[model samples]
Target: EEATLLLRYGQWRLRGASPDPDELQILFELAAMGGNAQACLELGLLCAKIDRQGERIFMEHGLANFKKALHWLERAGEAGVAQGWHALARIYSRSIYSQRNLQVAQHYLEKAAQAGLVEAQCELAQVCWRHRRDDPLNDVKALYWWQQAAAQGEPTAQAALDAFAAQPDAQGWALQAQALLTDKLRNSSPFLSARIELAATFGLTKPEALLIDIKAADYGHCLVVDICAHHARSKRRLIAVQTEAQRATLNRVSRLFGDVDCGFDGLEGNYRQRQYRLRTTFPDLG
Candidate 1:
């Protein structure tokens, strides 16, 4: 209960990353014993997402992790841990666990929703929306869960709500989400230099980003773009451009996507009249 409280109220922020190994061992042992499935699930995510002993060992060993994680989650689900059901739902939904059992996927996610996990609610809603809607999907239940998630102070939920609400203008909602995500992706990021490094590695002297699509869907703002580069001396530049509507969705894109090795070059330009180079790592040199 105390551990759950720590996680729920954000006290874990004070716990920091450098936890005592022995203490952490004891903590995990106790939590697993106590049927705190969230602890097991989170431990799995950490082990998978974080490096251990200079080796990235998570998904490579995910079969084992998921087994143990499911064990704890099933127990916690029976014991009425809301997040436990949520974990079980995620595992079942992911092919690693149940091997892509959509029926079970729906089952566990619905169970989690009944247990009041807003994240689960949003996910299940998307599933419902997908079955009923076409490209640029939407469903009433999906929108409801997004609203619920948004109201719970989940930034993702909020962004999603702004995307697909019943308003006449989904682009407007995307703009609202943009205002929320300004600080995370732009201005200060360690990966900021990584973008540049990629261009260097790919033999691209200059890369450009062209905004192809930015629109709100059933969940949140969706952004699609064509990025190009030129090693040619004459047209060596990167450009990114979007309509005002697209600019609003850009924030949504920044929040969800990390430094994907999509071969992105850089922000060549913004808004209309933006200048962008065309493709080719060796343009004029060739």
Candidate 2:
């Protein structure tokens, strides 16, 4: 813990002034060995980078350094650091590395996304959209993550959402999702608003379903909007209430965002207090 603290202090110093690389290296090594995930990640990155100062670190160690970097990265990931998974994904995706594997890369990216890394979510969405693997394309998933990142104020994700909105086949669901993510709603409850926005995006973007209507919930103190969606393939109608409460929210959101999607906020008043009327009546989820 001392070593990790020192390393963080050294890093903070590095932002303003030049710190001795030898000293920093020793601190990183100490902290990394002590199970500091951030230190391990930093050390891994240092090992992976080309040492231009004739230190001959990579040259002397050869692939040993790269392998060590992967070791530390895995350790960091095992410790539940999202950045570790993201870094590993990037390293595995790079063509210059002999260890390049898109499948492994995608796996780590998904792990990072599961850990709530916005960049990983955005990248995974792109991967889904591009159908980079032999696996079936999932535009719904692509839009889902895109909405996730966009709701978190990621500019790239916002641009992607805009692009999707421009596509005729996208059905303007992105626009609807964006509309629901207003600052007013965010101010009322950032956490709940984000979840509602996510649900809105998921409901509208489902490839198998067509959004039919959105109306006020029949009962609830929480701001709940009943979403009526019809499955295009099965011609089945389903209704999901978009609310901040954990009660009756997961099944629908997870259908698009994945089983790991569980970031729920219990704040609900924006919808209930500020009335927004609609002209749609649909069957409730039965």
Candidate 3:
């Protein structure tokens, strides 16, 4: 009951015409010490603010304030407040904080989203999309978070979902390629097999897969298949690496072709020779 009275007085002070920050801080701290989760959250938020003084005040006292904020927010999060985790994520992501850490921010953001915070879900989706080039699995993760937010009636997430749906689907091409390339035939020619698997994974055509340079084509987030130099009729195209399986296949194929020179006079020979080898290895491909 003492804790409740302290919290009430703190809230009352906040609602006053001109509240005393020192009094409110003391009241919230007393309540928070009495095991009040809401007090902890409120105290954390209060500590995180820099007031109107800006960088000068921050330089003098902001570090200690940030540390206190993290401590109280972590306590609130441990007490099952999803917004506490989200608040921590914000502080960790901002440059003003001396303890800024993107990796830690991502971890907390993910925790808040998983705990059913809609704002966290939306923000996490955007973060995943922005860093998709670092890890192709981020595309899949972004889609998942957007879907989660959209299900909760978030308009921006709904719009993003619609946009994702409008992009070209590559499942059909993947299925067709899967039907033609069997494990036995793929194993017959290790080099050709790797190319075929990679093509099927990213919806690449025969010419693009066989002639394109694996190392040169990989642009982290997407594959830039440009075989126009070897096959005049083929135009350069980009296929996004959206799935974990696609990333795995791409990594495997990249390692396979790492040492081998993929040129006209290389061990693999020209495009025609590679094509001939494929047909000879798999008689049914005719």
Candidate 4:
């Protein structure tokens, strides 16, 4: 019961509903002390994760906090949590804290994948394919790990495997792989604007529709584009544009969608008047 409560506190700390650092530290420490493996893992992740400005926390501690992350991760690993091993692998693989060792990363990834973690399998596959420092490229191992992840329904691994099958030399895949390493394609918002443009070009959505809000759905795989537009001379429509595509693969040519009712902030009052002014100002959009 104590462990459970501590775990709940740890989860609440990360919910972003609150920003009390002392509360987070208390929860994480209590949970970790109570032998909650998930808490240990989350606390380790919290410590390891770069701050909002892309800087590591506790820098003055001289990697003391990084070592603390590793300590908690090791404790979680001892508890037989596959995620702990995976997190350890990520920490080892990253250049953070002056400790980027691909071999050690691969070792932990093997442990995580053996314990049935799909993400670990995918990361292992990418690591195998990419030529990292002192780690020789191994396409055979890459294909093997990719097959493992794909069989478990990992779409990124499936896409990479398809790319490999199409071009054994992996010429076209280099750019894509590099992009993934730096997290360009992993980000979903940039694609939303492209999708919006496509919707306007095809008359699916009017070009002049005021883009009121946009957010991610399905764990950041799909975009929800919210807009306000005049559907007819007599009425204004607020629509939620749900773009559907294979996860992590949003080619400009790919098409998918759904919708929901519109809700807006600034445009909530004088809706018709604003709609008329917008339509008149952007006459070409309708």
Candidate 5:
């Protein structure tokens, strides 16, 4: 009860025209040390603000403030405050923090989302979508979290879902490529054959199939065929992965290219070499 009163008094001071920062901090610290979870969270946020301000004054002071913020926020999170994890995630996501770490931020965001924080769900969905190139399953995770946030009446999440639903379905361009894959070609150039199969499955053009960085292009829900660096005439595009066959084929092809460098300096050689190899393998192809 004493901690709760102190917290209330600190909040009342904040409502004043100009409160004393030192006094407020002392009150918050007293409340937090008295085991008030909300006070801990508030103190953590206050310390984080101080840390940011300290950045312009003293590097050591900034680092110390950040450590204090992290400690109190962790305490709040352990006390089951969902927003504490969200706050920690926001801190870790910013480069201003000396301890900035995207992977750690993602972990805390996930924790907040699982704890039923709607804002965390929305933010996590955006993070997954934005960084899909780093993890192929991120798109799938994005969809899941967006769905969760939308169900909670988040307008932005609903808008994203609507946009996803409006995207064009994958076309049927694989049949022609499939007909060209002879057994001899499959045995002799297994890598090229796999690329052809992936192209057929995902509707990739000849150049995209030959020159795309396979590992970097697979975004689970879509294939980002960007080979513009190697093929100057080729444009970057996304092929939606709408079918089970496309997913399976992508998985297989990605595994094949996992250990192989698909860049110009790698064993695959430059765009011209790959194109020449493709033309040599399938002389009748357009």
Candidate 6:
């Protein structure tokens, strides 16, 4: 219902940022009775959102409610709720609370993906990438998941693509990033289609100005790809980035490993080749 409301309004404002405390209490009362897992999840997310409202909670407030929300979200996830999987994934993906329960995070995200939640599909990719030190990234797989979400006209996925394409040499992280955008161009989303044409024109000149930007971005930034442990085919490509956010966009390079350690190397021609070699390899998880 919350998702539907947000979709209907064409914005989240329809649901307001915070749920009324009095209303939340009634929902909780209903949730406590039995198969009201939905209410439990809503109440949980409400409390969680409220707890984060450091400036809104008028009086009684602490981190307790935030923690309580997690408890309820977990219960709903256990009850096989798709929303619970996504909610739990959101909690786990946050750098703030992610470190708290990684294993649980993976569990919920996978469940969500199985339940056909595109948001959870995205989260599961992250969870899979973060599972170990050297999980391979197949940009194809990344594109696959992004395609699923983007096809639904999901703004977050579109935002992810906007952020992804903004990179100077986006191809270095994943051929699929380009493919993902291209797929959007071919099938749906006219905005991305126009974006593809712009990028092609930019690539034609092979402008060196983006080099300086890429160097600066690489200093402290990492590509936050929505990749799974897939060892797919490999390819040679160049990845140029401009902003920290674009650098942080989700992407996948097929079987290329160790990209995080590569500093500013040659920029003339083989930069993309070098990047591909240094990137994390996409394992043959199949």
Best by TM-score: 3
TM-score, model 4 to reference? 0.49
Number of backbone collisions per candidate? 7, 0, 0, 0, 0, 22
Estimate, for each residue in 38-86, the C-alpha lDDT of model 5 and write its tens digit. 8888788777864222223223433437788889989988899888898
Error of 2 at 243 (Å): 8.7
lDDT of all predictions: 0.45, 0.55, 0.77, 0.54, 0.78, 0.45
Candidate 4 positional error at 119, Å? 1.8
TM-score of each: 0.40, 0.52, 0.55, 0.49, 0.54, 0.40
lDDT of 2 by residue, 143-214 (tens): 667777877899998787764441223435433544546677556544334444444443434322222222
Point out where model 4 deviates above 4 Å. 50-64, 132-137, 163-286
Model 6's TM-score against the true structure: 0.40
Which residue pairs show backbone clashes in model 2? none
lDDT of 4 by residue, 1-286 (tens): 7977887866765667655555666787788888888778767766665342234554443343668878887888878888888888877877754888978888988998877788888877677667533342354556667777887888888786664332212232222222233234225333233333333322223322233232222223222232334333423221222234333233332433223222343322344654554345334432
lDDT value, candidate 3, whole model: 0.77
Among the numbered candidates, top lDDT falls to: 5
Ranking by lDDT: 5, 3, 2, 4, 6, 1
Q: Positional deviation of 177 in candidate 6, in angstroms? A: 29
lDDT of the structure predicted as candidate 4: 0.54
Error of 6 at 222 (Å): 24
Model 2, residue 104: what's the lDDT?
A: 94
* Location of the lowest summed lDDT over 10 successive residues in candidate 3: 50-59
**Candidate 1 local accuracy as lDDT?**
0.45
Which of candidates 1 and 5 reaches a greater TM-score?
Answer: 5
Deviation in Å, model 2, residue 215 alpha carbon? 20
For candidate 5, give the lDDT.
0.78
